[model samples]
Each structure stands twice: as structure tokens, then as C-alpha cells.
Target: MQKRATFRNLWLASAFIAPQLLLVFVFFYWPTAQAAYWAVTLEPAFGGGNQFVGLENFRAVFADANYWASVGASLLFAVGCTAVAVGAALVLALFADRGLRGHRLYRFTFFLPYAVPAAAVGLTFRFIFSPDAGLLAGINHVVPGLWNPALDGNDAFVLVLLGQSWKMIGYNFVFLLAALQNLPRTTIEAAAMDGAGVLRRMWDLQVPLLTPTLFFLLMVNITDSFVDSFALIDVTTHGGPARATMLMVYKIYLDGFESKDYSLAAAQSMVLMALIIGLTVIQFRVVERRVHYR
Candidate 1:
């Protein structure tokens, strides 16, 4: 009877998970397998006219200067956004860890932006910082032309950074604040009793203990900036006047959708996948050695 019950339970468990398994196989695994296969071959002429040429697509991807430049730009944007967002989140998390008045409300306010749609953020920011008749243009009256991306290359680059960081700050803060809140209060009090000032406690105690959370957030943030922030850049800059903001994903989108070059876009996407996977593996290798999960 017990053996029969165990089998029944296993059947029920599998039944419960079947839908999710189906969805994963249909959407994610199948699409990934197809894309990877497509990456190796030129898209055939409509109605199956072309032959499979393995590795040539990858070779072409490597030989393309524009592809390399777009990838470099994407890396630059990801690194810059990660630095700003993570640093800001750490500071904000520290602040929220203290029992300040209306702290919960403040935390909610900071995290609210993350819940907002990325496409909306991109659209709103684009209008808010337009060359003419934008909110930023109005602010220039008091701030003495503080928003001028039109005339300066450096300023435009900075605007992209600011937009990306603004969108990501809340997302990082949520994870960081959770980590801070979960930390041992007694340990912090003990540190204080031992004459450890705020900075010292943070540097010596909180940070070391929070390494696992920090590493997780860092990986997520970088990966997000790499792939998910395309909407923000697409709406704000459209890769911009001189391709200053031409992230690799944007290039892929342009090639795939805009130019209808499926083969080229597939190649670009494959390269991106390689980059993300390689970096993630390296990060895990290094971080897992030191990450303190407890």
C-alpha cells in the first residue's frame, strides 16, 4: 500500500510540473536550440534554397568591425551602469538598514521605479531629455544649460549612463536592502561596541558577510545591462547620431528586424551568448571561492 501511495504521489508531482516543463521546452529550450543551429548557417533563401555553411557565420561575425564596435559599446555601457547602480544601491541599502523615520516608505519609493515597465522608462526618459522642449531643457534655465547632449559627444554618453543607472538603481537596491535587513543586528552592535565606526563596520563586517549577495547582484546586474536594457537605449538614442550608444543587442535588433538580415543577426546573438556565458563562468569560478553564503 505504501509503495502504491509513493507512486501515486510521484505521478501527482509530475502532473503538477508538466505544464511548466512543456512551456520551458516549447519556449526556451526549443528556441535556444534553433537559434544556436541557425547561428552556424546562412538563412536559406525563402522556401529552402540555401546550403548550410558551418562556422563561416562565426568567422564573418569576427571579421566585422561594426559588430566588434557594437559589442565594445555594449560592454562599456554594462560596466558603467553596473558601477553606478551597485555603488548607489550599497549606499542606499546602508541608509535603510538604520532605523530612520519613515524608512519603509523611503525604501518603497526607491524600489518603485524597478516595478515600472522598461519600455515606459525608455519612452519617458527620451521625451524628458529631448534636444528641444524637454523637461531637462527647462531645468537648464536654472542650472545653466546642464542638459546638452546635442552639442557634445561626452554629454550624450553621460546621459545614456544616467538613464541606464536610473532604471537599474531600484532593482539593485531591492536585493541589497533585503541583504542588509537580513544581516545580524547583534553582530553590528558588537562591532559598534568594539569602536568600529560606520565606515569601518561596513568595510570590515557587513561587506565581507554580504559577499554572496553582492556577487549575485553583480552578476544579475551585468547580465541585465547586457541584454535587457536594449529598450532604454533604443528609445532614448536609437544608437544615436554617431553610433555612440550602439549596443550590440541594438545592432542585432537592427540587423534582424530592421534590416531583415536574419543570418547576420543570428551570428551576432550567438557571439553575445558566448560572451555572457564565458563571463558568467569566470565570475562563478572566482566568486564561489570566496563568497560567504551564510
Candidate 2:
């Protein structure tokens, strides 16, 4: 028989959960409701009054070529970051699962990046990729201006993509390592008995079993790459020399705060929310079917 905790008093249970409920209402629900309202209305730049406009702001946003460009850039960033982060993390987790010498130290070292603030990581990468005196400058000695991200659009995109991927690698590593550890050892040992090499075993045996974790991480990392990357992009490139790295989230910040167009910003936020929700739903509907839970 399984045991479960029960609250005998309803008032006591409500009291115990009240603070969390209040915080969620205040922080999440309130702001989301406000954004939803503002999305369908026009507000004065100085915030004196609001006029309800049905889908006008969204129409304007959709009509803008730059908005489409930002969408493209965001998609590219999300895909590139997700692929690189998940791939690198999986490779590292596989090696770490082998119990190499000082594996515990290596685990801590890898996870250290995830613990650091994204802003700090961005700043660090900014200096590291600087065209003049950065580590990349050393490469420029052999091929002058070859590594300059400051002036090139493609280079700038690559820089931000690498920064975002590096920041996420540690987080994915932790999850991958945990999932790998939890997998049944009997299956792995059976594969080993068949004389399967490490790489062969990983591809044939371990990977299929890890599909659920991999799929979950893919959905999470893709969504996170869309929203959570604003800080990193802002600190590193600020959407770059030609808006090459202008992700949708950063565009929302620029429009709302920098440009002071509250109506447009709110509409963009609504679109972004809808996009994330839609993608999540699609993932659960389409991708989850392929996940092997066992």
C-alpha cells in the first residue's frame, strides 16, 4: 500500500498554499493578463489613455519586414543553439557516465557554467570574441579580419549562437547525465556481452532508451532559446551591427522600452506567447508519440 499525506483541516491546507498562490497570481497571472489586454488595444506613448483596437497592432507587426527578419533570426538561433547544446551535452554525459578519473570534479566544472548568470557569460564571451584584442585576434594574426564579428553579420550571428549554446550546454549535461545514470544497467551489460563497441552500444542500445529525455530536452531547449536568450543577446551583441542577431524577445524589449511603443511591444509579446504555446502543443502532440518512456 502506498502512503500519502493528507491535510485534515481544509483551512490549514489553504493557509499553507496561500503564499505560493498569491505569488503566482501577482507575478505571472497579473502580468500575463495585462499584456493580453494591451495587445488588443492602443495606448498613448505617454500612457494617458488606451483605445481598444481589434488586431490592428498585430496587423502592423505582421506587415513589418523587419519583424519577419527578426522571426527568421530567432528561428535560426533557436535551432542552432538547440542542436549544438544537446549534441555536446550528450557526448559529455556519455563520457562522464564511464566513471573516468576525477569525473565528479568534471561534473561540477561543467555545471558551473549553468549556475553563472547569462549576462555574465555574455559579457565574458564579448571580450573573448572582440575583434581588436580578443582571443580571436590571435587568429586574425594569421588571417587578418577573418575573425571579426563586430563588422560582419554572419560572424555576429555565429558569435551569439555559440555563446547561447555554451551557456546551455551545462544545463543539458546535468539532465542527460541524470537520465543516463537512471537507465537500466542490465540492458547496457547485455549489449556489452554481445561485443558491441562503446559507440555502437550508445547508438544502438542507449539512445533508443534515452528518447524520452532527449525529446523533453529538445522541446525545453528550443523554447528557452526563444525567450531566455534575450539577456545573453542584449549583453553580447544588442542585435548586432545590422540586426543580424535581433531575436524576437530582444525586439520586444527594444520596441517597448527603447522605442517606447507600448502597443506594438504588447502585441509582439502576445505573438511570442502564442508561438511558444503553439510549439509546445505541437511537440506534445507530434513529438511525444516517438518518445520511449521505458
Candidate 3:
């Protein structure tokens, strides 16, 4: 009787999960499998002649100078956006975690940008940085070329990094703020009673407990920056000013869909997937053990 009851419960659970499992298989696994298959082959000739050219697509990727440049630019963009966004968010979260007047209003103000669509954010930033007759240009009158983020390669790179970071800061802050708000107050009070200054308590007590949340946010922010910034890049600069901000996803978009080189795009995408997977693995291996929560 117990065995029958257990089997019935398992069946009920499977029934409830079936739709989600099927959706994952259809949407995620199927497309991933197709991309992986295409990454190993050249575009097949029409009329019933297709050859499996193993690893040639990836070989071409390695041999292409433009591909390497795009990869480097992508790495730079990801690191820059992640560092700035996460650092700024961490600071904001820590400051706001304290009981300040109008804290709710301040939280809303910071999180407002996260609600803006990425395309809109990019377009808005472009207008702000336009050479003349823009809000930033008006500010530049007093600040002197402060909005010239597109004048050259270096300037363009800086503009994209800052724009992306600004868009991401709110999202990162929300996560860190939740972590901080949920932290145990007893330990913080105890530390304060022990005559620990804010910095000392943060360094010795709070940060140790916050490490897991910080690591998780860092991983997610980096991955999202790499994968989702394609739309922002496309709308803002189109990887412009001589490929200065031509990141990996933008390259994949141009190569696969725009240039219609599906094989090359798939290969590039596989490389990105590998990089993200490796980073996630490292996060678990090295960072997870150090996380402390009481």
C-alpha cells in the first residue's frame, strides 16, 4: 500500500513538472543542440550534398583576426561594465542599508533605470551624448566637452562602458540591497558594541557574511553583460567608430544573422557559452566555499 502511495505521489509530481520540462526541451535544448551541430560543419551545398567538416568552423574562428579583436573587445566591455556596475551597486546598497530619512524614495530613484528598456536606454544615452543641442551638450557648456563620449575610439569605448554600467547599476543594487536588508542585525549590533568602526565592521564582519551574495551577483552581472548587451550595442553605436565597441554578441549577431554566416556565428556563440560555463564553474569551485551566512 505504501509503495503504491509513493508511486502515485511521484506520478503527480511528474505531471505537474511535465509542461515546464517539455518547454525546456523544446526551447532550450533543441536550439542548443542545433547550434552545436551547425558549429561543427560548413554550410552545406544545395542539392543533396553536405559534408561534415569537423572543427573547421572553429579553426576559421581562430584564424580570423577580426574574430580575435571582437573577442578582446567583448572581454573588455564585460569586465568594465561588471566592475563598475557591481562596485557602484555594492556601495549604494551598503549606504542605503543604513536607516536614512527618505530611504524608500531614494531606493525608488535608484531602481527607476532598471525599469527602462535597453533599447530606450541606449537611444536616450545617444541623445545625451550627441555633440550639440543635447542635454549633455548643454551641461558640457559648463563642463567643457564632458559629453564627448563618441569623438574617438577611446571615448566611444568609455561611453559604452559607462552607459551599460548605468543601466545595470540599479539591477545589481536591488540584489545587494536585499541581501543587506536580510542580514542578521544582532551580529552588526554586537560588532558596533565592540567599538568597531563602520569600515572595520564591514571588512571583518559584514563582508564575510555578504561574500556569497556578492559572488552570486558578480557571476550573474558578468554573464548578463556579455549576453544581453548586444541590443544596447546595436542601438547605441552599432559597434561603431571602427569596431571599438564591437563585442562578441554583436559580432555573432552580425555574422550569423546579418552576414548570414550561420556556421561562424554558431562557432562564436559556442565559444561564449564555454567561457560563461567556465566562469560559473570557477565561481562554484573557488568562491562558494568562502561564502558565510549566519
Candidate 4:
């Protein structure tokens, strides 16, 4: 006979979960509902009142070329950071999994970045990168203005990309390493016994098994790229060097806080939300097909 566990005090169970539900509603749903309302309404800079203006805000946002630029930049970041972070993490995780000499130290060091806040990582990289007196300054001291991010928009963007990718790598590495450690050792041993070399075994055995983890990381990295980048960009570039790294999320901040255009900001935020949702749906529908879950 089998027994099913049940909560005798339904009120107690509900009470235990009430805090989490309240937090979700307060943080996520409330803000989302407010954004939805403000997106279609115009609000004056000095806070007169919210005025319902329908989709006029969206129309203005679409008409602005700067908004489109932010969109393009966000997409570029989403793809670039994911590819760089995931690939770099895979390499580090593989090396760590081999348990080579000093691997314990290596594992600990590799994961340190994940422990640091993104804002802190951004600050550290900014100190190391900025044009005044950092790594770039030292390089320019010899090269003579070869890679000044302050003067070069492309250079600034590259810095943001590098910093963002570096921050994401530690997070990806932790999960990838855990997944690698759990994979069946018998499969790897059999492949080696069959005369498969290291690369062959990795390609034929390890990588396929790693697909599910890779897919999950891909989704997470992409989603995080769009949302979590605000703090990094704000600290490092402030979406500047002539708006070169102006991502969609940052654009919303500029519109609302800096420019005092709440309605337009809300509209931009809605668009950003839609973009994230659309990408998530596509990833699940298309990308998940290739994920081998076994």
C-alpha cells in the first residue's frame, strides 16, 4: 500500500506560502500592471497627472531612430554576451572537471566572479579599462591613443561587451561544472576504450550529453543579457560614449528618469517586455528541440 502525504492544516500551508505570493505580486505583477497603464497614458514631466493617450506613446517611440538604435544594441548584446560567456564557461568548466593540479584552487577562483555583484564587477572593470588612468591608459601611454574608449564609441561598446561577458562567465561555469560532474563516467570510459581520442570522446560523448545544460544556459544568458545589463552599463559606461552601448533597458531609464518622459519610458518598457517574451517563446519552441535531456 502507498500513502500520500497531505497537509492536515490547509491554513498553515497557505499561510507559509502567502509571503512568497505577496512578494511576487508586489514586485512583479504590480510593476507590470503599472507599466501597462502608463504605456498608453501621457504624464507631464512635473507630475500633473496620468492622461490616457492610447498608443500614441508607442507610435512616438517607434518613430524615434534612437529607440531603434537601442533595440539593435540590445540584440547585439544578447547574442554576443551569450556566445562569449557560454563558450568561455564551457572551456573553464571542462578544465576544472579534469581535476588537474591545483584544480581545487582553480574551481574556487573561477566561481568568484559569480559571487561578486554585477555592479561591483562593472566598477572593477571600469577601473581597469577607463581612458583616464587604467589598463587602456597604460596601453595608450605606449601606443599613443590607439584604443581610447572615451573618444571611440566602438571601443566603448567593446569594453561593455567584454565586461558583461566576463560577469556572466562565472555563473555559467558553476552550472556547467556541476552538470559535467554528474554525467555518467561509464560512457566516457567506454568511448576511451574504443580508441576514441580526447577530442573524439568529447565530441561524441561529452558535448551531446552537455546539450541540455548548454541550452538552459543559453536561455538564461540571453534573458539576463537584456535585463541584468542595466547595472553593469550604468556603472561602466552609463550607456554612453555617445550612446554606443545604449541598450533597451537603459533607454527606458533615460526616458523616464533622465528625460522625464514616463509615458514614453513605459511604452519602451512594454516593447522591451514583448521582445523578451517573444525571444523566450522562440527559444522554447525552436531551441529546446535540439536539447537532449537524457
Best by TM-score: 2
Ordering by TM-score = 2, 4, 3, 1
Model 3, 30-121: lDDT tens digits are 99888998898776656354458899999999999998988889888888988999899888888888868978987888877888888888
lDDT, candidate 2, at 179? 91
lDDT of each: 0.80, 0.88, 0.83, 0.86
TM-score of 2: 0.91
> What is candidate 4's lDDT per residue for 216-294, written digit by digit as tens?
8898898898999888999888888788999999989988999878788999999888878987887787555754433
**lDDT per residue, candidate 1, 1-294, as tens digits?**
246444558778999999999999999889877777777777566676445888888788889887788878887888898999898988888878776898989788998878777778877776777666777787677777666666555566667777778888998888888888888899999999999999899888988888777877788788888888788877677787577788888888998899987777888888888888987997787676755532
Q: Give per-residue CA lDDT, model 2, range 1-294, as digits (tens).
A: 555976589899899999999999999999999998888999766757788899999999999999999999999998999999999999999889888899999788997788778898888888889888868878888888888777898888888888889988999999999999999999899989989999998888877878777888898889989988988888888898788999999999999999988889999999999999987997787554755432
Model 3: lDDT equals 0.83
- Provide the TM-score for each candidate, comma-separated: 0.86, 0.91, 0.87, 0.89
Q: After superposition, how far is residue 110 of candidate 2 from its true place, in Å?
A: 1.7
Q: Model 4, clash count?
A: 0
Clashing pairs for predicted structure model 1, backbone only: none
lDDT of 2: 0.88
Please tell me which predicted candidate would have the highest lDDT against the true structure: 2
Q: If ranked by lDDT, best first, what sequence of candidates would result?
A: 2, 4, 3, 1
Worst 10 residues of 2 by lDDT: 285-294
Question: Candidate 3, residue 232: CA error in Å?
Answer: 0.7
